[model samples]
Target: MTRDNGFSRRNVLRSAAALAGVGGLGGVATASDGESLRQIGPADLSDVPTDLEAVPAAAVPETSSGIGPGSMLFITPPGGGEAACTANFVWTDDSGTTYLGAAGHCFLGSSAAGGTELDEGPDLADVEVRVCVDCQFGGLSALVGGLRGEVVELGDVVYARQRTDDGTEVGFDFGLVEVPSSAEGLIDPSMPTWDGPSETGEINAGDTVVQYGNGVVTGETVLTKSRAGSGTGNDDASGSWTAALLAAPGDSGSAVQVGELGAGGLTGVEAAGILTHVGTSGTAGTNLQKAKEMATEAGLSIEVVLAG
Candidate 1:
């Protein structure tokens, strides 16, 4: 997901979540007035009967917190000070719409009480974010990706969940950050096919193919078990990668390519909705279709608005 903030990324990071940011990430973001603003790319808060509604998929038990922090981990951009508490974020109906999001607040100081004080100024009042879900979460790289983001055993100065002002947030961990180039990383392979090339499907067992994302640069086969299916969850096909490519936290919302020449015309991409799985060690999930909806919901559609 993404957002526009006049404030330098340096000023948009908070300190509280910084500590837990890298380790155990909880809900975080910014807000304006009484609304919680979100920076995540085009996401639809519309309560649709999506597959995500039936999370935990059939493979993973519903009771399993295998999805969000409970079901699994979903990536969120901080919208306020060092502590983008509830105040920092503002959602019209608590359903998180990206239009009102602000990253400046995410980088506010510890003293910024939720949003009592527009600590970071008004730079981030509005912006757009791009993201993809339902792509690579459950397929194969889940376990490895989750554990990898959870903890990197790199000894001293370990930057697991370290907080960062806009500056540092970009490289929070050894992950790839998809900075909205074209409408590329923001489409769902499963949703209706886009104009030119498009990709979709589940990265699960018996799914032979290679994936391309910021992580493990080289294309590699999917790797994992109990992958995500047609649930309300991500459209990312799960799989087991025998080769070695890595997925990192910053790599969320990146592209996931599978096809001939080790590249398909278009498929789902990668996202961070998968938080528990051995195979996901270095990867995540993505759904371009959802991203389009989000864009439309945030008023950043193709008709008008700033360049996405």
Candidate 2:
């Protein structure tokens, strides 16, 4: 499985549990309103359905637009702080609402009122989604906190959830941030360094995988943001998979694609999963297919928004 330097990532998560701000990271960019917002935790695992609706394969459109996969997501929860997470794939609902994919844990802060589990709660509000925040300026620009881009006011957290068994976060922690029509011009469905996630596919134990994340732990540097690693296969019945990729605290919610990185990044890539848990065993991801199933159970009629 993906391994880090035994860093108590869970502790980092809890300490920075709100997953709310970039300001604390020093010059990363700050929320303008600076007002308090709501925190949504994961729903019960049993709430997911046994028989889920089959989502059709992602349809590749002739054209795609702006900031999307590989972009940074800034979340500000109720406690008045902001956190950063990497945007995964893009999705669209039947109603024409565009949603950016992220780890459910990204919005999780402290626990729902009166709830003890970290992964239990309702939806989130006032989330600030910034696409290409400092991507154009490159890592140097981001490091010095020069020209951080504008915030894209995507709609609220339409659907977010995580699954845990016996109080253990086994897998399946993912969420969707609805992109408003005004921000459509900035919504590109393609992965940045590595391109095609032509369709959703499975990951085998030995298959190679590629990912790009904008975690603060890596200073949001381009060099370490994109990585390639090997899969360790799926966890037993948890609808999650493990990998040997390099990951850090803010790397959560990054997309994991099944493919190989050629001289020009990933070639013939397929969306596999979203990085959720990073620990001693490895980096665990909620399988892309399983995530869809859970979304279906939540009454969301959506499909992966493929790149051009």
Candidate 3:
């Protein structure tokens, strides 16, 4: 695996340009999530990568771009400076409706344990979608995600991109959905069920963390995590003690699991940690209660919690 230093503005910019752009952070939501006092939208929204940097910030909507499977991506108005990390593209639901998901903390730019709160959860919207300048093809993960994970930008104009096997940065346009919040199902949790008591564990920077995404019935895709320090939350309950994984920006909110049958259930949720000098690396988040809360806010149900 490649060791990410996180200080490469040049490299980040290069990746951003290659992406035209792409998508971090945390105060995790436990029983004590939001208070409804926080206002959603701009003034807090910052651009995604350093490259597709936006000028004045804007409000985030509760929607995902029509395109999927790219290195986390977003677009600005024509040339609204650059794009900001709208939110993490948590995965999609049935019927192919791409859900624009993010941590309650990222959606809520406020103060918290150890996470960095930015955009608001209610600000999601299915805006327009933009494709990579001259890119095509998707990867195994992207293809499964319904989202294209190629490198992307926050602002307009294809600048550069991070490294990828495809050798091309992919961009996407928003299909524009008119949903209020897809986080409802989680609060209830009975939407549907995947087979797995599963479980949650931790990994260090050197250790390889693995899990399954996409969906339950489909298949398990194994990817390694770089293991950042404490996740978005400050307390030990937030994450386990792991070195730092090369967990990238697009990886926040991913479910960590053991390499067993069916991604071996789950270990913990991945979060984009607070960066000191090093770059993003990754976060080791546990606390299933917090995950359940997040799922509730997003309107998704926790089919199962992989208890360790």
lDDT of each: 0.22, 0.57, 0.25
Best candidate (score: lDDT): 2
- Comparing 1 with 3 on TM-score, the higher-scoring candidate is 3
Query: Which scores higher on lDDT, 1 or 2?
Result: 2
Residues 1-308 of candidate 1: C-alpha lDDT, one tens digit per residue: 11111222332232112222332122233211122211211111111111222212334322221111111112332342111110000112123211111222222222222211222222222322222222233211222222111210011110012123342221121111122223223222221111112323333333322322212111111232112222222332221111112332222222222323235553323222211111221232223333333333433331101111
Q: Which stretches of candidate 1 lie over 4 Å from their true place?
A: 1-205, 208-245, 261-283, 302-308
How many backbone clashes does every candidate have?
A: 112, 10, 92
Candidate 1 lDDT at 139 equals 12
Q: Write the per-residue lDDT of candidate 3 for residues 1-308, one digit (tens) a residue.
A: 01111223443343333222121222222111221111111111122223222111122111111222211223332223222222222333344333433222222223221111113222332232222211121121222222222232221111111111231101100112212243223211110112122333333334334422221111112222112123222233432222233333333323333222235542233321211111223323323334333344435443231222
lDDT of 3: 0.25
Candidate 1's C-alpha lDDT? 0.22
What's the TM-score of each model vs. the native?
0.27, 0.70, 0.33
Model 1 weakest lDDT span, ten residues long? 151-160
Model 3 alpha-carbon miss at residue 14, Å: 8.8
lDDT of 2: 0.57
